[model samples]
Target: MFEPEKQLVGEWVLDVRPEEVRVLVSGFQSWSEAELRPLTDLQAVPMMKWRHEQGHDPAFLPSGEAGVWRSHTLLALVRPDGSGWVGCAVDAAHTFTHWEARVDGQQVRVTCTSEGPAVEVAWQDTADVIGTLETLSAQLGRNMNAITPTPLRVWCSWYSYYRDVTLENMLDNARLARQHSLPFDVFQLDDGFQADLGDWFEPSSHFGGHASELPAQLDALGFTPGIWLAPFLASPTSKLFRDHSDWMLRGEDGQPLPVGNNWGGPYYTLDTTHPEVLNWLRELSATVRGWGYTYLKLDFLYGAALPGVRHDPSIGRAQAYRNAMQALRDGAPDAFILACGAPLAGSIGLVDAMRTGPDVAPYWDEESRRVWLGDATGPSARNALHTALSRWYQHSWYQPDPDVAIVRRELSLLNHHERGSIAGMLDIIGGLRASSDPISMLDEEGLALLHRCLQISTPDRPTTLAQSFGGAVTHFSRGTFNLTNQSVTNLPAHAYLEQRL
Candidate 1:
């Protein structure tokens, strides 16, 4: 019954239900309206979900412009408080028609930018976001296609090992896990094993050209074989770059565009729309999955969908992005796809889990840049915790994977207090939980901390807004566990440190 101000410039109707709300927006000044061309009769979709994308850029913004905004995806609205939630049913698969939810204070608009005549959107609220999401998960997997994600207490070679991890490093870590009888579900080989960014089939020189053996060895050790690949990015030093310069996505000037400065120099994007690149990706996907690795962490995935001059100019960026992901799905439907640095809305249903925040570095604090980055900087543990907690609602559908929990006393810049805080936050967030520290390098104290974290679970959804104290002390409660940056003295143990603008 609430009508908007005259200045709002649109006629809108809302259907409010007990569990959810549906908004039908029409009668705005569209080009079609000017032409008086009526929309054809079609069945309105039953389920429309929103996703608060933790976009590629650290400062995630809802953007319709391609490449400029790599993160926020369709139905980009979030609950904004208490339990910190959002959910998507994946019905919008390859069917985005500019379903961006622009929020202004309490007011928001869902605009239809594509050829679609109008936009139909849905919003649902619940005390337990995960409970609702599992229902959707079951619904999503009704055909029994979606893979159930196992709790990933992965022994990842990221923070401690990074790109320096070799076959020896992985074997030594796996050996340590076996000797100590450590609890690890997956032994992941992060970035270093690849011969080059685009050469997924070849092993790096560090591995003596047999990286495939690493996965089998880990599996024999009673752990799932996990591997990481930035499938969309090809490094300048890669064979793919040298062999097929035409495969690279070019800007309007016909020169290859650099995605970002990651694997040394600026990495070039693979034109997913190109037939050669598409087939290459398909073969790569099948080869990796066929190698018996159940877990694949696809990183820098935003590059796949960035706005650029593609082999086919007719396709939209999102369309190109979906096509690339669909190729991987066609190749490996059963593998658990953990999307890292992926475009938020573009990856629903296509991925089993997503790295919803920047990488958690060994260094804990970002006080100097805290004001500047404000939870958007990469390689920050505190910023990761902040982002994970805020976008937690997405955990109800695809799992929210905050990066790793580093507790090793050596080679880490995080102190005891910072380490404990990060572990606590990860446990509370309830997604893929992994320790990047090598157990062999960990002291008794670090091992004990990991043991305690394994016992922790997601807390009950909080009903109140997170209270902030001075700036340093902030906390929120999940029900089973409560996490805080630091214990808020003279107040409660927690305060919600989500975002205060």
Candidate 2:
């Protein structure tokens, strides 16, 4: 319980337990009555769908104006001046926890809600924002029993070939790897191979109607075969959605709940709580693993947890998401599973690796951010770096995949310095090293840069803070390099790593 120096304005019944909690904090002064003034105020972390979200912005200072902020399972009010700060987080097991803060006039009201876990809230007082976060993340990791796997260097076909990837393109990259002796551990076929989002069993026309043979072909080239899928999503035109409408999560009106707009139109979420859906998920995982692909990248997983009337009404959103994950794990026990666009706390112990940020584009463009009206969760180099740098503390729970390292200049708009900064930033963070560049088209320098980025040694658990000194410029010191000029999609984007001896 938080004992503030100021009198409590309003309160709600807090059902406290080891795994969940729900409380309403209405109108209060600062967490502490200390004399030290705050340099900047308020920090909130997003729950999931980090793309195009505003809660995790470093330059976010909701001091005077009325504003609302939301975090998935944690919220913090930090005073970076070494004064006093308060951090609140909940243990999300069978529940999904979220914190929403509303600033009205001079009063601030924060409500912490848990969909279903046994209520447990952790309150801490500290000025060290990063240290407090690290401690909390570690505690959550222990509670979830998360696994940290050795990161693998991967070559993906997403940004390189996009949805137009063909059998020749895969083979070309594979042959280039063999010829150049690239030490890539996995060769992954991204979204293009699948016939549709929900129909994962059949290949699209791109592979001449056969993707199973490519795994063996990739294995022959000395790389483990990998694949990508949005296991919980079903496109409107998908056979799964057409044949089994009951498997889809529904709204109060009994219509399929629209998860998001992608793959030509709106897609829907599968109700993992549905027994048949869980069985299908398990069979899907088994089929993929049986194809000899050992690495799996499950993406757009937030759809599974979207609010809807589930088959099992007792299960909350986070638990529903975990149910699908458990089925996949049961079916493919030995395969490495990478969770992307997933609820952070819901996926802690289930996945071997997790994408810690948005997709990385080939250029430093913010058109998506502009189109989304300043949603920082879009595809861009700056957005990727900013979010990854902010969430790097999560490396304790699983291998942090900071998307792909785009280094090839052939199809990119990133300048030399910008590319170098991105490579340097990822190298310092030292998470999963992956690239989507066509190695066959790379010049010697580009190849060398790709090689340099892949030659990364995972750092010990991070304790250093990534400080944003205004203008979206963040600094995090690791090894001999310090990331200094990274932006959070607010300013003209550029990244530079300054050496600190």
Highest TM-score: give the candidate number: 2
lDDT of 1 by residue, 212-304 (tens): 888778877888998888887888888999999999988778988776665555778899989888888888888988888888888777777
Span of 10 residues, lowest total lDDT, candidate 2: 27-36
Query: lDDT of each model, Cα atoms only?
Result: 0.57, 0.65
lDDT of 1 at 54: 20
Q: Against the true structure, what is every candidate's RMSD?
A: 10.5, 8.0
Writing each residue's lDDT as its tens digit, candidate 2 over 229-332 gives 88988888889999999999887788887766667767888999999999999999899899998999988877776666778887766678788999999989
Of candidate 1, the 10-residue stretch with the lowest lDDT total is 29-38
Q: Can you give the lDDT of residue 116 in candidate 1?
A: 14
Clash count, one per candidate: 13, 10
Q: What's the TM-score of every candidate structure?
A: 0.74, 0.83
